[model samples]
Target chain A: MGWFKRIKDGIQTTTKDKKETPEGLWHKCPTCKQMLTTEEHAENLWVCDKCEKHHRIGSVEYFHILFDNGRFKELETSLKSGDPLKFKDTKTYVVRLKQAKDKSKLTDAIRVGHGKMNDQDIIICCMDFNFIGGSMGSVVGEKISRAIDASLKKKIPLMIISKSGGARMMEAAFSLMQMAKTSAKLSLLAKAKIPYISLLTDPTTGGVTASFAMLGDVNLAEPGALIGFAGPRIVKETIGVDLPEGFQTSEFVLEHGFLDKIVKRKDLKNTISNLIKLFAN
Target chain B: MATLIEIEKPLQKLLDQLDKAEHIQNESDVDVSKTIKDLKKKLREKRKEIFENLTAWERVMVSRHPDRPYTLAYINAITGGDFIELHGDRTVKDDKAMVGGLGSIDGQSVMFIGQQKGINTKMRQYRNFGMANPEGYRKALRLMKLAEKFNIPVISLIDTPGAFPGVEAEERGQGEAIARNLMEMAQLSVPIICIIIGEGASGGALGIGIGDKVLMLENSWYSVISPENCSAILWRTWEYKEQAAESLKLTGEDMLKNKLIDGIIKEPIGGAHNDPEETFRTVKEEILKQLKKLKAIEPDKLIEKRIKKFCAMGVTK
Candidate 1:
């Protein structure tokens, strides 16, 4: 009843005509309850203008935002696990893979690109939380590992955007191995003296946090992103204490020195470009 | 209860008989002498056999035995009283869960860092049951960086249930801290040797675990998940932990066979706790030998080989 009342209040305040509102024309801000036309959402880069909420963007969108003139060559992940564990839960692993593949129209959680940031060459490996919860199995792991290899070979800065719920449990042990694999290759990146700036979006947790996402030379998180290892419910059950308010948020993590900076989504490209230039010089 | 292992029940029974016989008889009591002697011989044989045939779960039990010597004890034994402990991650208060400092093996200066468990109730609470927070790992990284600065070799003793899973740990970046260590250690420009002196559960052990040579003590295990946790997740109950240990292939011998680890350091016949002196000697010898070989390697070559070594691990079929 309370939720219904709130919804009614929101509709009453909106000036837009209900009948004329086109399905694809308007998108409501999940945080502040402001309805914006599709044009307005794109103009704001999907950021909620009223609440400053950073909406989730896919890897393709990220490539456009960071790469020069929205032009870049996409590097194929070409990695499919072959459903390695034959992992099945309520649905067979094959069925889940097929459904996710059909929905996301992507091979795996990650998308790799060799592109330019402010006309400077760089490598980008961006993850999508929509794909299998952005779980890092062998495919995602190998793709990122290969991206690191490409960066090493090219001797360029690397930036990885993370959005995930951690390792895919369906993939089981095969998923766990990726943590080590990514971390080992990341060190090779470090040894090559290449700068890596990790950009963490909402809900970066579990094995990814334990590996490359946290291994960046300069760790940056978007505002209000949920970045941590164990999620809240598990932590609450284990520690038997009320967690600190705003804990695991980007701002909170920054205060504790876990993150180097909290970069708003709007400033990410310019900031990364500046960093690459600074380091290069 | 002395916590006799289930598989040792037969041996325990014989020992109990000897205890009873010794108390009820004088030296001239001839009726039970032959029986007691035979029982003693049988107990000895049974103990030897059990030690030889211990399953992975039983070894897990031994690794966590109450009387087992902890990280500090081994450090003291290895350093021969020449050790100094450094403190703090410099950003937060010193996490006693991770203890490290400058120490030595056979008078050669080496840096030592390890997860420390409590010897008693008060200490255990203070140690957080050897589960580290983010500061613990950052503190370890700081010390590791210090070791690298001096170009000194590092010896990391791993013993943790896992990284602390508290909300605070997550909020402060426990996973990131561990991940950063794995990446940084690979390029430290100094020899890094890791030994699983106790439980090596997932990311916690691996925080400081990536090394040129990773070793494990006999009766210790290194796995992606602890047996109990693995059992709970896979079998949906902790009751199948013993079976989980078997299936996980977590023992040091298993690790050696899989090429995840370089070698398995032998504990005393029973365990490290049964004869600490012998344990200390064997551990020291193993460290010295590994250090000798590691020290001979060029820094760049060492860093290269170290990365390749870990990259080769868990290339699952």
Candidate 2:
């Protein structure tokens, strides 16, 4: 009877007077279902403390992780995609671009910047998966090409962090041409003897993977990243069979002799600097 | 899998009517020659009209027509059966999806490479429907490097649904193979010409597509993704493929206008399937013309221009 009775008249705080935990305060580990404070999760470089899963992050987080003091000079911020095909689907491509821009606060899928990683000068081009699934369009291609040119002119090492779905379907052949365009520019970079490092993150597939993402002199990848020519779904659909465990992961790719190394997020800057120094020697 | 394109269906009916009229005349004492002649003229006008204003989707259909000449057909016709089929990447099995060889085109030794779709159901299965695996692309690159060694002009005919989307393809590094080809092709010291004779989808086409000059057949489509795939992605269904095709602007003319291609090789009326011989002849002439022009340049300059041409692609602010 005492247990059933209200315990000393439950606290009289009204709903209006009570406070709620703000949204985004906590982060959930997708792999292990562990919850932790967002700050703690971010401090671990977005890797799950329990399961070590690397959560997909954007250019902002990458810049923070790699750039010295998170300070760098962003390049070609003014460039945006044109509706060359005047493409339309359920919605016009122009509208989709606008919506993606507003949501991601990015002009396009990629951001190029030059900064010192461990005090070593390097040009980094990072893809934001939030922006149209990091699809390579004209803007992405032009930006990467310019980044390569900068690396050549300045004689600095170039690094690209690929996190993409594929080429932008809306841009059509213009998107397809980006593979050739960026690869050709990398050829120029290769001729100049500038060290080129490609970092493949989660979900690098399709045209992006088949071009500059795989053209690096040294191809590095994050652990457990999905790195392949075709998406797992497409591959499964095409092959009509269940894939093996760890298929197309960075580990699998490394084992298959496609990747040079797998570096942890915390060691990325140091690993890159050391590789650049080695190339310099 | 409809043999006749929607726009060409009326023309097919007209031709059928003409055939009936001719049969009547050939039979006992029935004079239907005048009707046959009038029907022939009408068929000509109908064909012209159908081809002239073909929707982009119809062009896609034409590009995939089963009767269209595959890569080997063009190579054999151009070389007068003088093609010596090259086999194997030397590192892996010879991929049937990609066919390459040394051939003589008008007394000039040339290296020919292309994605070879099958001519029949069985062959299509054998060829994997023209979808090249990593080994296929590697074989292509090997042939191109061989052409570079011998100072022969390299001609690549592109026709593929895409690079093969299989687990083994990824395991073998499809992307790296294509990427290496692009980089190596950009600097290869031989005249490389790429012609999209059929489907040119994504990295598969570009794997062997980099060249001093890139041309596309009139009905063929070259795009980042096929219209059906694009529609599936954007509209969440394949039913909107026609709209997707129109939106993609992936036809040869669109490519020319976009400066993604050097020129569009006009197809025979209806499509390349309607007159494979004429298609082969036109492609041969275009390839020879482009090769002559490209060969005039020094190797170093050719490489430089090739890089420059691709570098100049992609419209950005």
Candidate 3:
């Protein structure tokens, strides 16, 4: 009767009466198109339970997964990128940095943490693709350099979880020099006989791959991760030909004898711990 | 004659006029020697002015000028027919894009390595447009290690658009090859000098670019990405390449200002293509000077200094 009678024609509700579902409440698997709650997704370490596809995760997730009791001490948490080149392309580099910081809530593309992994002291520098595509700028370089020093000083193993789109273009030559800077530091790590594990995740390409990402004493990658010097699109455009399926994937790289092993996301901590133990002996 | 860029067009016109005047004075009985001399003086001034104030994009154009001198040209001129060419990475077939061998600069034996672009279209295709594949970088590493074995200082001339971007290049592990070079070159016990002779784009250039003294030739451009590529990425179009070049600050002066490079070697007015011999001479002198400075340090000290030098790069707050 109330519905039939238009007593309150155009029945109004106050703004406070409106209710809507918040974002990030549900997750959709890109590979399987399966729907699951966010909690379930997080419980699975962000990997798709239905398809076993490893969705790209940031440093926060990686640290929680690898660190002991999800506890760690962050290094250079305030180190930020300087506008060395004062670059501007549709937007000023400073503005872009601010925007990236605001959107990602990160200081830079990389975060270095000191913690015990499987009861073994380790220094891990993880890159976040959410921050400017995880492009290695001056700040990333400096942080990694410092991390290497930390590893050398503490006599602990070092690990880098690389998920990047290569060198930051806005920094220009400064970005290019980071490659040399980080590699030089890694050479010191090698000289120190410290175990340096490089973990390549999804979409690691460009200068990062050509520098520290590949200089690992033991190079490991996630399943189906994209790892290469050049992006597939650039390669395709340069060759003017169609790329075969699964090109530049972790499997392809492993087949090419570039990678040491392909470890699943769930087994990353144990596998890395085992590797550190092997290096220890 | 070498091809001229947009900024060099006026200089080219002036040069043509001077040529006509000289030809007329030589062929005929006219006494136009004064005119020829005046034209020559004017041409020199214009060239200096044009090159001295070149915009970043103009330098990029000059760096990529088809007639610009390539690595082999400099090696040949510097070594003066004393270069012994080496080939192959031992594990893979030889890559012509990369050329490395033993050479002497005024009887000082050195390992000369560089990326060599082709002189013509056919040769360009053969050289892969100066883009090295993984094997090319591997070959460079093999040569560097060989140089270290012989206690020879390594002089690497970097000039490349970037590493090869083909599927086979990726399959062959281009990134690892370059990465290995950076790590190995960092501690090679021998003095390493890297000179950016031209287009030093991203990791391709840095593949062999780590050194105690990293220098750049005037008119050469070095950056994380090529101007066109950067423009394409940031501006979503290549039309803003000039703007991108300015923003990138990729010229030799910019690199020196940023302390990314040790110094800038002056090129002949217009560019290296204008007077290749003079450019070669200046490069040889600079190399010799830097080599002398670097050679005085012991290997251990040299390695430490090199690492420190690179570690000091990058501005962070």
Candidate 4:
């Protein structure tokens, strides 16, 4: 059978077998059309085993994968966003926010909390790129600020894994204010003698990369992640020049020494745990 | 595609010879110190005649010189011995742009925090051009609180156009970080000394700018917002940044005159990049002098001083 047909058959079979509905599935090996099941794909962290092409995972799944036995206490989740500008640049700000909330099933773009990676207590704040491209708004700012506060209170360190598009335009000036707000929180952490490390994942860009994502005590990156303030395309357009090949990807960034380490997804848990243990002493 | 190639034998031979000429060019053709001294003499003569009416753009360029002494350089220059870096906000990732650690300056144990700008392309990317995010500021706060715990003095190096304004930064709470730092820093008991080493733009710089004694390097610039952003807002033209710079009064001289900075550390002729050693020595002396003055002040007085200093910023006539 042709590879495409086989993949189609696999998806059809999975859909037919599962009585419960799947949120949404877009699984395909670009190079080789191999039928892959979500169950089979889940094990590889959404990388196609046949072609090795990676897929984006939601923040909830990401936390589950990184933590031991899905053990994590979500902190500062109750914080809601305020419309600081009563902003009106595009469609109504409230409407866009409500849409983003519904689409991502999240109150804000990031999830911040404390969790154990191999039983090592650490703070984990993951940006949900799926949420309005993970544009940071007031709630995200408040949550991050609180996360740092929690870390300081607990005297533990933080690990932030970021995958984002940049600042949320709907929030306008209030969104811009977050840069200072977050930096101030970090200053407090510095004062408190706590450690905060950043894990730059795929497509970390804009205001996010400009701020906390780039401000890691020991910055790490996933293989092939894109890390920069502007996307290569946008920068090229703005600068009126072609970007060098492999300009902003994690490997290129690592080569340029933007990342302290280029860690593989499979090994990320162990690596972070080891670092946490080293610091704990 | 392969058939059109032609080899330039003569050119290839010359290129090969040129490649072997120098790997590491260490020896100077002229005596560097002597040449610098002569240059300084010329600068001094020129300064007396006419301190050239500097354009706002020139100040901006001066603020961004690659060779400018950054926070890390100052820390290394002022503090002797091995330094240990502390990490993590205990809730998120460690921030590289804002580096804080336990170290000794002139044999006295202290906690240090600085916004570090990397020298080369690699380091700049690593340090994010000293533009910290929420986490970097949080890390600085962590260090400050730690200093209070240990009763050690705190020194912060301020540089950066502003905090990172990216989606992730906002998502993670950039504004809250800066606000909390401003609020909490005012109450911290440790004697804090802040030195504006380079660009000190906007809230990113201010996040760690709350200090008992705030100093500015002669060539450094600090402002509420960067000239470029201001221009974009005021003129709807980023290119008009030069005009915005002039209006902002961002230079150390301007800031000192306005009482934004407590004092200015003299830089060598031209700029710090022109003579790093001289710049280093002068900064060291000034910082030591300031620290000594501050060491005598009680903790309550120190906090009060910091509060008063910030409250008084941008109070225009």
Give the best candidate by DockQ: 2
Instruction: Report how far residue B55 has shifted in candidate 3, in Å.
Output: 0.4
Q: After superposing candidate 4, which stretches have Cα over 4 Å from the reference?
A: A1-26, A29-35, B1-317
Would you list the C-alpha lDDT of every candidate in the order shown? Answer: 0.83, 0.91, 0.92, 0.71
Which of the two candidates, 2 or 4, achieves a greater TM-score against the reference? 2
Query: What tens digits encode model 3's per-residue C-alpha lDDT throughout A115-229?
Result: 9999999999999999999999999999999999999999999999999999899898888888888998899989989999999999899999999999888899999899999
Instruction: Report the Cα lDDT for residue A13, model 1.
Output: 48
Expressed as tens digits, the lDDT of each residue in A1-281 for candidate 1 is 46544433445645565566457998899889998898899878889999999998898788878898888888865567565445443456678878899999998899899988888999999998888889887778778888988899889889989999887665544466578778889877886799999988998988898998888888999999988887776688797888778978888878877788998878989998998899988
For model 1, the superposed segments whose C-alpha errors exceed 4 Å read A1-44, A82-103, A168-181, B5-11, B21-41, B48-59, B149-151, B167-173, B230-248, B268-271, B274-278, B314-317
Per-model root-mean-square deviation over C-alphas: 5.3, 2.8, 4.4, 15.2
Query: Per-prediction DockQ, in order?
Result: 0.36, 0.80, 0.76, 0.02
TM-score of each: 0.83, 0.94, 0.95, 0.50
Global Cα lDDT for candidate 3: 0.92
Least lDDT summed over 10 consecutive residues: which range in candidate 1 chain B?
Answer: B308-317
lDDT of 1: 0.83
Q: Per-residue lDDT tens digits of candidate 3, residues B1-317?
A: 55667877888777888888988998999999999889988988898888888889988888989889999999999999999999999987999999999999998999989999999999998998899999999999999999999999999999999989898899899999999999999999999999999999888889999899989998899988888998899989999999999999898888888888899998887678988999999999999999899999999999999989888888888
Best by TM-score: 3
By TM-score, the better pick of 2 and 3 is 3
Clashing pairs in 2: none
Query: Cα deviation in Å at residue A213, candidate 3?
Result: 1.1
Per residue, candidate 1 scores C-alpha lDDT tens digits across B130-155 of: 99999999999999999999988999
lDDT of 4 by residue, A75-99 (tens): 8767766664353432556777788
Candidate 1, CAPRI quality class derived from DockQ: acceptable
* Of 1 and 3, the candidate ranking higher by lDDT: 3
